[model samples]
Target chain A: MPDFDFAQPTSLNEALELFAADGEVRALVGGTDIVDQLKTGRRNADMVVDLKRIPELQRLEIEADGLHIGAARSLTDIAEFPVVLSDYKGLADSSVLVGSWQIQNRAGIGGNVCNAAPSGDTIPALLSHETSAIVASSSGRREIALSDFFAGPGQTVLQKDEILVELVLPPIPDDSASSYLRFIPRNEMDIAVVGAGSFLHLGSDGAVQKARIALASVAPTPVRARAAEGVLEGNVLSDELIETAAVAAVEAATPISDVRGSAEYRRELVKVLTRRTLGISRDRIVG
Target chain B: MKHISITVNGDQHELLVEANWTLLETLRDHLRLTGTKEGCSNGNCGACTVMVNGRTANSCLVLAAEMDGNEITTIEGIASQGKLNPVQEAFIKDGALQCGFCTPGFIISATALLQRNPDPSEEEIRTRLAGNLCRCTGYDKIVMAVEDAAAMLRT
Candidate 1:
């Protein structure tokens, strides 16, 4: 790793100013992925603006709107937060599943989304909740839906001078629940071969009022299974309907053959995990 | 170069370090604390595990500059007044280590686990120590050692 200047900015404005002054700069939070990237020469920067010191980026608040998760909050903190665990179980599940316990103690949702890996665990879960990313730059702040934030693998719509500030999730409706599941070769400390996250709101009539499905490790970015979700909307969840939605999820995936799994295998896992996650989400609503 | 203050093993040190130097490098090269072994250095193996502010973390993944104003505990800090910590004693008594290369990291991780959860079930112990990899002893003795350590601490 090459030597670079390091700045710990206490405020978002100061961080933005530092970022604007430096042409080649990277924001360091947990440094779990980026440090490794730097060691491997995969990423290079002249300065690293540490955002962990920024108070606003480390706060976690639950408001009337929903939960406001500070971008720099550790995964462990988010996973164990009472509000998150009770109201956003899928996010909590994905938070704890990001890495090992030690990694979770440092890694946060911000770096996870910013790194923008196709197999990132938190992404599909965030997308399932319809979360929005609050990004800040010298120009000002803007909110981008989590689904629209990712441009590609290892890329996002965030400008070089911009930093992700927080993730805002809308108020979870009554009788609504979500689940995130992934097929990993190992139980822990391994990336997902295929991941699925499902969020569903069941109406009093026992039909699906709303449904959101997101799949990971199946495309260049975490993708929404819109067609699969379309199958669930306004319909009672039956095994046959779930099978159809699962098939649609398979069709939605555009996985490539990698060492972890073949494209076909990933597509198959997508169907299986999609079915399983939807089943879990439905059970949460009914049970 | 970056000047950072860190409390390691209860001793405070102010040092000038290169920005790219990891906490592992700072400990081994600068502070001369070679007990924290570097196995994978990519966060895959927890050979460089240390307690940063009472929580175990992979020091290899943390930049030295980030250690500023942080309290760190390494394997060297586990002993007290020339006495081996209970976890270390249990490891020795249970024959948990063979090569001893991964011993320090496992000790640090086990100490951390016991600190947080005094009475950890076998499965809980396994889950907590999942990050640390030991090539020798096949982990059975290591698990027994942590269990024994928990019991010993309770008594």
Candidate 2:
């Protein structure tokens, strides 16, 4: 790891001030990703701007508009949080799948998104739920849809000197439920070969009023399968209906073969996961 | 070099270290607390696992300065007056170790899990120790040891 100055600012204003003074400062939250990058020589920042000390970035707030999850809030915090589990079960489940308990305890949601791995477990869940990132910079703050946040692999739309302040999940539509599912070669510790998340809203007559489906590790970025979602929207979920949607999801995937699994295998798993996730999500909508 | 002050195993030490030094390096080199072994310097392997602020963290992935105000418990802190902690004893009795290089981290990680879950199920024990790579013992004895320690802790 290259040498760097470390600064721990006690407040958001102070952290911003330090960031404004220097362009080379990189914010450090959980150290789950940054530390690994530093040690492996994959990343080198001249200064580490420690954001853990900033109290504002650690608060999780649920309000009338939506749920605001602090950028620095750890995955353990999300997985164990009752509101998250009860309201956004898909997100909670994804949080549990990230690395190990030790890593989950230190890994933050913002870091996961900003790391921008195609296999990032949280991205599919966020995209499925129509979440947006509340990004802040020295100049100002703005919101961007989670779908628009990722530019490509290991990249995001976040500008230099800007930090992700919070992930804002809009209020769940009535009679709606969401679920996330992933297939890995091993169990919880390993990254996903294919990940899928689904959100389904049912009408009074038990027909699907709206549907959202997102996939990960099968594309350049977490992608919403509009064709798959179109199959479910305004229709009733049946075994045959879900199979058609799942096939559509496979058509939407752009998986690349890697050490984890072959692109064809990933596409197959995406079909399986999409079917399973949609079934579970539909059940939640009805039950 | 950067001067950092951190409390390890309940003792405060003021020392100067390289700017890029990790908490694992600081403990093993600067303070000579060699009990915290370094495995995968990245967060994957838990050989450098330690309890920071009552939570298990990979010491190798954490900078020493990042833990200045936190309370850290390493493998060296598990024994009280030369007496093994119950978890350590359970590991020994259950034959949970083979090479013992990863023992310190396993002990620390298991202890932290027990601290949080008190009486975790067998599955919970396995999931919690997933980060700690133990090439030997096949983890059967390690899981048994944690279950034993949990029973001891409850009683």
Candidate 3:
């Protein structure tokens, strides 16, 4: 970690002004990733702005519209929040799996998304939930669909002068449920080889009224398995139907081979995890 | 240099820290608290685990400037008044460590686990200690130490 100026701005406007002043500034949230990047020379900063001090960025609230999760709120809080756990189980599951318990205590969902790792656990879940990011700059504020937030690996659409303020998840329908699953060689502390998240809304007749599937570690960014989702929408979920959709999910993936797994193996895991997570989501739907 | 005030192991210290200094470096070099070992310097290895505001974090990943006005409990803070903490006593009684490089981290993690969940099942103990890696011990003794520590604390 090279020497840099650190500023803890108490307000979003102040943080924005600091960011506007210097393009070399990086927002320090959890520091779980940024600190390692600094140490490895993967990233450098002349000035690091700490956003945790901003009151708005630290809030986690459940309201009529939906859940407003502050970008800087710790993963531990998001994972354990009763409303999040019950209403957004897939996001909660991913949140709990972000890192170990210690990492969860420091890492924030906002940082997780902003870091934009292709293997980020929260992105798939967020994508499935139709989450939106509320970003703020000195000039104004804007909301972007989380699905459109990431540009590529370690990249997001956020400008240098903008900060991700919060994530808003619209209320999931009463008949809807979601699940997130990832394949890892080890039980813990490893990045996902392939990750899948499914959100399903069952019609009164037990047919799939709507379906959303998202995957991670398969492309430059987290992706929606629109083809697989198309297979499920307006259809009944059966073993054969689920298997067919899983195959479509495999088709949706564009995984790269590396030390963790071969591209072929990742594609296979995508099918398996997609089927399994879809099943879990279907089972979670209330009568 | 950033001037930060922090409370560590029941002592208050107001110190000047370089912006690049991690809490691990500040603890080990500046404060001379060497118990918190630096293993990976990254978040992967838990050797530099410490409690910040009652939650365990990798000190290597935490900026020293962020410690201002925060309560930190390192390996040295676990014991009280010259007495070994229950987790430490259990580890010694169970011979849970070999080489001892990862002991402080494991102890701190187990302590935090017990603080949150006083009576954890064997599976819970295993999951809680997963972040702390030990090469020498096959982890059976470490698991037993945490269970015994739980029982001892309960009594």
Taking the tens digit of each residue's C-alpha lDDT, what string does model 2 give over A1-287? Answer: 78888888887778777777654777788888888888777877888877887777897879998888888899999888888887898999899898888888888888899999988999999998999898887798899999999999888998886888899998987789899989977866788889999988888877788889999999999899999999988887688999999999987899999999998999899899999999998877667
Off by over 4 Å in 1: none
lDDT (C-alpha) at residue B25 in model 2: 90
Per-residue accuracy of model 1 over B1-155 as CA lDDT, tens digit each: 88999999999999998888999999999899999999998998899999999988899999998889999999999999999999999999999999999899999999999998999998888888888888877899999999999999999
Ranking by DockQ: 3, 1, 2
CA RMSD for every model?
1.1, 1.5, 1.0
Model 2, position B79, has a per-residue lDDT of: 86
lDDT by residue (A52-82, candidate 1, tens digit) is 9899999899988889988889998998999
Candidate 3 residues A235-256, lDDT tens each?
9878899999999988779999
lDDT of 3: 0.92
TM-scores, in order shown? 0.98, 0.96, 0.99
In candidate 1, the residue pairs with backbone N, CA or C atoms under 3 Å apart (3 or more residues apart, or in different chains) clash, namely none
Clash pairs for candidate 3: none
Tens digit per residue, CA lDDT, model 2, B1-155: 66667778889887776757888998888788999998878888799999888888988878877775678889999888999988999999999999999999999999999888899999889999999999988989999999999998899
Of models 1 and 2, which has the larger lDDT? 1
Instruction: Tell me the interface RMSD of every candidate, in Å.
Output: 0.9, 1.1, 0.9
Sort all candidates by TM-score, best to worst.
3, 1, 2
